[model samples]
Target chain A: MIHKSDDPVIRCDGVWKIFGARASEALDAVRSKGLSKEEIRDRYDCVVGVCDASFDVGRGEIFCIMGLSGSGKSTLIRHINRLIEPTAGSIYIEGQDVNALSARELRRTRAEKIGMVFQNMALMPHRTVLENVAFSQEVRGHDVRERTQTALRAIRAVELNGWEDKYPDELSGGMQQRVGLARAIAADPAILLMDEPFSALDPLIRRQLQDKFMSLSAEMKKTTLFITHDLDEAIRIGDRIAIMKDGVLVQIGTPEDIVTNPADDYVADFVAGISKLDLISAGKIMEPIDAYTRRDGPIDFDAWPEAHPNQSLDQLVDLSIATQHPIVVKLDGRPLGVVTKNALLRGIKGDTAPAASAA
Target chain B: MDEDTTFNILDPFSSIDLGIADSAGGIKQWAIANRDLIQPIKAVFNDIVTAIDGALNAVPPLVMLALITLIAWQAAGRRTAILVGLCLFALGLLDPNAWSLAMTTLAIVISAVTACFVIGLPLGILAAKSDGFERLLRPVLDLMQTIPAFVYLVPVVMLVGIGNVSGVIVTIVFALPPLIRLTSLGIRGVNPSVVEAARAFGASPRQILLKVELPLATPTILAGVNQTIMLSLSMVVIASMISVKGLGNEVLRAMGRLDAGKAIVGGLGIVILAVVLDRISQGMGQSGRERGQRHWWQSGPVGLAWRLTRARNETTPPVSAAPRTEVQSN
Candidate 1:
């Protein structure tokens, strides 16, 4: 919070995580020859965990990495914390080159700047919920009073105040996950790396924890790299989502961008099931207001239903249903385009920009 | 005789030499004379045994019996407690001075187990932490465990001479391997995910060892200690061959005089002791380290028995046993 530079909180350029004996050489080969993942694996006995991943996370944004297993999403995030070293590439956090940090400096950075939550929720069996939450502070050598207070505040944040003294076994899976989250935020670090933190919980609990996390994220505003395989979750939680396939970053865009204008069929198929209710905006589907006004007679601006450029497909549909006339999509309350019924339907059904205009 | 015929089994040129007694005796004399400064070290071993033996003997038999029974009850269960009490009582009835003899054996076992913990724990940690150390220790432990029990006594007797101390030394050597092996296994078996989590939180190596590895490995380490105690008990009778006085002395004398009754009684005493200690230690490991809750009524036996014996108080459940989940099931 103190350093309010416009620089992104986390930046990784050409981050490569190749796992094998000759990982460096394999990366070089991949860079020079553009080796396929299968070819690299077959030729060098190396698994390309992440093939040149590069992205920047805004200071307060939740950038979700969406991928199925073997997609290198988890491996990519670990590089940010130095939990796994990259074979090649540079990572900078707050303008400090992470790859250049010494071991001691890296440790301090992990302790002081970044916090992480994992799917396993590996709360120490011996430690109580409170002590587990206080772990990061303890690592940084915070005294008993300060750490306990910070830990308590975090436990409270996760709504686990009364269960502070309970061991992990005594708690349910969701509760354990809460303790894991509490542990991560106890230090109140600037960045968080959450690796499928709720994947193990039951669906009901998972949704509940997701809601809990969403609210907490808004309140804390910490830069988060959230890894998940579920497309719906990424779309729901991420400000911008990065999709990975076979160790390569296939696409990175806002949820709206990926949903409305997919980079390829792979991304299109991945987002096929996602509802167009929230993502497809009036601005994306609108026709030129000038030509429409010229063709039609003098139209009273206030007579017809109006919508903002950022209005979701659901909102536009509501507006379309309310009035006989076309919807005027506005940017900064100034008319930028018109969204007729046919154009709205086409926008909803088609990926290409409003395939045909409506009279 | 042929020039190379000395290789024959019956040849007298350093072959088929029946000088076992001479060499052993010579070695013993040289050892006692502190030829390699072995006697001074042996004296240190004597002091440890003496202190432990004195502490064990210091308490009265009835008090010790009650203490052991209570610990067994708390750590294991009512069944173990009952069994230990009955066994000790039978031993006391069988031998005129069974209490004293059992006390003497207990002293040696305690000393030996203490030594095992002191030496084996660090070695175990080292072996667990370092792959090279673990590899080095594997063969050494295998040898320590596999060697004949009597073989260790010979070297120990040569250095320390036949007495209470030498018996303890030999028993320690015989019993050391389990703690070492088990402790290393326990530490190494700590969940990798847990370790990784600790690392992610920026825990130093030392902090990780203390906070994560040790606590999770406690139950396994406790199991090792139990095994060490059992091995120590088994070796006590053999230890008495060198005149470490205890129930073992009774058995040894019984065998010499063909007294079956005394031998059976002595053997039974060792068995009962072994079972009692084993159940208690094993039970402790099963329950695991003191964690999570501190109930008002869980202030040891006084509270436990009161709670168990008293009519189930339905009001105000223990703090630790409180409902954990706040999320609605609907």
Candidate 2:
């Protein structure tokens, strides 16, 4: 059987999660009202936890679902894992319709192929760090020695070595997150789902863990779906960010695309006060260094400046114009190309930079 | 009096006189028929006398004191244990042979309490799970607990005809209610979150009972067991009336003989035994509470089991090795 390459590790298509009696009639009424937010809320005591939401996460992509509290970001992610069943429409996990699976099969799938990290860590209080990490395997009837080794490897990957004996209560919030991550990855699941896994941590610890998670994802290359209300976090870790508003998917795009050209006024307003420099990437502004550029003491390709990938395009444009020379585009001191004023301006104005072949 | 009235009264010719005479004849006939049934009861009385005699003749006073001291040392913690042991030793000095009878009574009470717990815990769990069952059982348990211990002797004598079996049966009925109530309360009081977490982990109902509910409720259940033991001890004095040989019988014997010192010593021995058992059971409950806060054993054993299972999973490669496909949306 042929499978589509663009297929998501988990897909929820036109899914509806309505919570009320006469839900079907209410849904019909909302549909007749063109499913406007106000009409849906009024017509049916329905919550519309996920309203006709449709999305897919590609293999190895860190797709983020972001929204304010009660906007259905968590609900949408849960639909993929089937933690909460959708009232209408279909969800597919690894090409098998999730709703079609028996309870036992679904449990098996959750244990073997998918792992979830909950917002509160959800570590079993009675279990220690090792037991928590190895729980899924244990449920699947894995023997002690093998699962322990697997758990240990995962713990090491999350940088939680030597804390295996400690209970979840003994660990700090950040350490608990590491344990949660280890537990999720211990089964070597194909798809890892996290629901605001770091939102409970201090900002600094959250950022640190976020970086660690990204690096781990890069290494393991597993498809990941994360839910969070933090936009900064979405930009920092998401390969593709999906913004949700009131149970509806508002927009889905790369962070640069979202920052430069928000799909709607709501999304634009959400990104409004954030510094544009923080949103522009070196790839977006880089241009070829031409003969018109003055050589500044043998342009050191290895010594290019570093900027946050999220820096505003305007800041890059101003910096380029002020520098009066093609700015070198480098990531960790390996030159990719250059950024001239024209190219930086084009990036700022939401116009594509003229193609210049890579060196 | 008229001559006819006096003659009728003397001749038993009236209706009331005939009825009384007939009832007296019936009583005589019933007693003769039940003579065989009454034999075991008579034997029990004889056995109690002989046992008390043997206890008085065979055991030295100091030995009984030493045995009491040892029991106290084992059951209670060191301080209370020591205090109890010393008290029993003093009692033995007053009358050593009575101490053996006292210890035997303590043994019977403890055994009766243990039996009550065995019967009560499962009933408690059932009650906690089913409201209808609990409602049905409530009135019955109320009757069992409220009826005086002495009242049980009459029916027991009619059925089993007076012995240790009858005595234990009464004690079980008297002491069982606390175990049932506390066990039910403990099971019901288990944390909801813990239960939810266990469910999410795919624990079956049986697993949930063993792993989550039972362990968490253990401290409370143990407390019930302690109460049952105390109640069983309370029944010992009443049990002696049924000819069950124990400290109660020795005490009764002393009171009959009007030996005040022997009665006091026997009563003190019973108190010492109760304190020892109470302290030990309480200590066990406290230790359980302390152990509950620590997860070292759970993680160690459960984690080891999980690890071994994972190893088996790896060695036996999955049969359905399809590169798990990702579902796409249009």
* Candidate 2 C-alpha error for residue B237, in Å: 5.0
- RMSD to native for every prediction? 5.0, 13.3
What is the per-residue lDDT of model 2 for residues A233-278, given as tens digits with 9 covering 90 to 100? 9988999999999888999998878877799999988877545565
Query: Once model 2 is optimally superposed onto the true structure by TM-score, how far is the C-alpha of residue A89 displaced, in angstroms?
Result: 4.0
Each prediction's fraction of true contacts recovered: 0.76, 0.11
TM-score of chain B of each: 0.81, 0.66
**Per-candidate TM vs. native?**
0.88, 0.66
lDDT of each: 0.85, 0.74
Report the C-alpha lDDT of model 1 over A121-146, residue by residue, as the tens digit.
98898788988999988988889899
- For every model in order, what is the iRMS? 0.9, 3.0
- What is the C-alpha local distance difference test score of candidate 2? 0.74
Model 1 ranges with Cα > 4 A deviation: A1-4, A102-104, A291-304, A331-334, A350-352, A355-359, B1-36, B77-79, B288-299, B302-330
Scanning candidate 1 chain A in windows of ten residues, the lowest lDDT window is A350-359
| Candidate 2 stretches greater than 4 Å from native | A1-6, A18-48, A72-85, A257-269, A273-275, A281-318, A324-359, B1-202, B227-271, B287-330
